[model samples]
Target: MTSQKLSIINISYKNDESVRVLTAVLSKWFSNPKTLHFTSPNLKYPFNINHWISTFYNEDNIETYILKDENWIIGHISVKIDENKNLAHLFHLFIDNENRQKGYAKKLIRYVEKHIIAGKDNIKAINLNCVKKNIPAITLYQSIGFQILKEKKWLKMIKYIDKK
Candidate 1:
């Protein structure tokens, strides 16, 4: 994930009317009950959009990046870096179903590593919460150098950052 071909596209948060578009895209990604229900562990049912936005965007930790083709938003990835715990958590990572296997996730993650973590001076590790049911994500994370620091019914993954 750290080194991939997605560097060509810019990764950034959306604003203005883009938020509405991003929200629609998020709704679409969550349209599948199976995908949405099991994406995060310990999430209470009836996920609230206001709460989701508040948690990330209100405090400025949540980041939403669109993969655009000229002017259309093809996909997006959201991340939240918790300074309190020194954890850069991946909140939502999804590519448009039509745009999968193009290494979008890999590139976005690499962008996070370089600009988000490497740009900071005191980050300890990147941590994210994933449902135990998400084996595909678990496998991908493992392949991308993440290890299970702790595992309950869910997973808390951490990838330590170089401090020096």
Candidate 2:
């Protein structure tokens, strides 16, 4: 069987309509209490859309992206860069429940690593925190050269981006 290729669409927070679409997708994903807590530990239960908007869309340093396979939204991921620290933090990575295990997550990560961080001289490393129990996400991060940092509660993975 042949597989379909997914495209990463960059979302601009300045566009209210686009932000609404992104928020809707996030709201749907965060609707599940377990997913809400797992993806966003600081957020309360019930998945407030306004809160989600304020948290993600209002951030100037964060850039959001969505992975789509022609017809469906496969997943979403965001990168937040700290200019002072020269660090890029990966956040809110979630693959649709129906699209899990299809390698979309890996593709999304690679896209960010290559297009987003590779050429940026100021970006020293990329970091993300994966819940210890989330074995699949941990494995994916490790496979993509993210080393486990010394953290107990949540596994902190760091991948140094070499500038060319």
Candidate 1 on 1-164: residue-level lDDT in tens? 22332323434343556556666766677677665666543344455555556545665666666666555555566667778877778767666677667766677777778876787776788887778888877888888888888888778887888767
Considering every candidate listed, which one attains the maximal lDDT? 2
Over 4 Å off, model 2: 1-5
- TM-score each candidate: 0.78, 0.89
Lowest-sum lDDT 10-residue window in model 1: 1-10
Model 2 clash pairs are: none
Count of clashes, each model: 0, 0
Best by the TM-score measure: 2
Of candidate 2, the 10-residue stretch with the lowest lDDT total is 1-10
